[model samples]
Target: MASVWAITLLGPARQRRSHNDDDHHTSKEEDIDLGPEPCIFTSTIPAWNCRNLERLASKTVSPLVFAHVRASTEGALADSNCHPFSRGALMWMHNGGIGGWKLGVKRRLVSDVGDRWFEAVGGSTDSEWAFALFLDSLERLGVDADDEVRQRDGFGHVVLRKAMLRAIERINGFIAALPAETREQGDVRCLLNFAVTDGKSVVCTRYVSSRTDEAASLFFSSGTSWKMQPSSETGKGAGKTQLGTGEYKMERRDRGADIVLVASEPLTFERDNWVTVPTNSVLTIHNQTVLIHPILDQYYNHTPSFLRSRGFAIAQGQTAEDRKAAITRENSAAALDGTAKEVAVA
Candidate 1:
């Protein structure tokens, strides 16, 4: 039930040089590849290690970087409970928790997985267990979760996306099978924002299992480069380091996205730089192209005008005010009529 503060950084791959492209005078931003292995860091007290983390990140370069800071709702403070859990080259992280996990879903999910995945769990956390489930899902799709070649090359975006969706489906099934009384005694709805990558293609989800509740807040920014802006840069303002000395900006030198970032919240206060990933949809970042696909299922909101409440997401540690322009007239009317309370911003 912990609130996972996660960040996923995807650096564009090295494009093979083509003779004709050089003659065309096309400028391409290349991500400097320092090594093959990804650099991952996790902490229960990130503030205590901010300087060390920053130093490590400054020197390391990889195609993908996944970082997590856990605000515990469950499990003891330990390294094994930290996220961006990895198996070979595949890395996984979750921002939300399994609904009614303690009520029975955990036991059911644990019992259903094979011994390999079951034994792979080294920590007492829903996030790590969820990763194990994802690995099991990949195996069920006929892909070896630990294949050396696939680990190096990647499991491919299509296969990884399918496995992610299947894992979510299985989680829903487990929650559904809970006894009726148990389900009634507690919230059975899940806020499942998951990200998985094979150091190549990355897939992320912003999903909630209820049609009337918004999922945990997730935002993404993509551009040609993530550049540092001058401190004097104007407007909404740039983000600062803990020392408050510098700022950063997402610079779009061209239409192509050479850098992609996904996070539970906007990394900077520059709201224009980020876009909210639609609820109940999977976002795929492959080959520097960002694609979003709806998760078609029973919990999907078929009505475009329906407004989902953020109350549930807020209670679960994610909060976002619905834009006034996006709220439908019907919902606005209800709010005015006292049927629904207006969301206030201080």
Candidate 2:
């Protein structure tokens, strides 16, 4: 499954530059500061590589940063198809798919977007088109995506949130409009874990557009610092060839979320530091306050203990370990059902 990670540093400004001198030919390094403002960096390369990442990360520290690694089920793998898409001052990333994208819905999805946003689409990914729709929504709401005035004014949390919700609604509407035969074949269930920021505030969501199927796995970890754990104590990578090639941990001295990290899987095995973002909920991080809201739709499930099968998620190329976990969960559910039936007979 696709994964996304973000960090919001809530203090001080730092100076940094891109590692690619040639790529920076069009834009100057000074023009990309995160001081009292938001700046984002995204790469198609797997998170572990991209040498510029370490260089920029080590020097350019900000209160907010986001990263995503994609496992494409609906999109092609290319540099432009990567996450962390930005338009003007808005930076957006998504780790899920738009259900029924291939089955004629692609035309509808693109047609709804405005000409400007439509032209901005660079890659053949549904995710990019989704971003276009988001931009169109913002523009339709009278906040021009490319307007400097709007960027300076800031879209505000309300506008951004509403536009995001509208984007999801539009996708659902398109899926609903599809013929029954097409719907059955396409398996039009969506997993929409998204993160958006303006270098000032961050809003994220963990949602699935199905009542009986699980969304792509998304888990969040927050703490004062994310650091390499003591390898000696954990007996992991103590004798490794590399110095910093060890497992990391989320260290929390207090309840305050100084740094927030969200991903499809826990970056490290520090179980106590991470929490599962409940399905169909939006996790908003505004000024360090984390708020979660349920995304209510026809596919939404209200029951507390209701479990969505993860088989579809696994088949879409989730890690083997995660697939095994889903199998274990299915077995657990089966056993529980058996016990309930026996008790009813007794």
Candidate 1 lands at a TM-score of 0.82
In candidate 1 the C-alpha lDDT for residue 49 amounts to 49
Predicted structure with the largest TM-score when compared to the true one: 1
lDDT of 2 by residue, 199-242 (tens): 66667777778787777667788888887754333466456443
In model 2, the runs with Cα more than 4 Å from the true position are: 1-45, 72-75, 232-245, 318-321, 338-346
Clashing pairs in 1: none
What is the TM-score of each predicted model, taking all chains together? 0.82, 0.80
Q: Give the top-scoring candidate (lDDT).
A: 1
Worst ten in a row by lDDT for model 2: 337-346
Write candidate 1's Cα lDDT for 193-270 as tens digits.
999888779899999999888899989999888766555434556453333445677888888898899888887779
Task: Evaluate model 2: give its TM-score.
Answer: 0.80
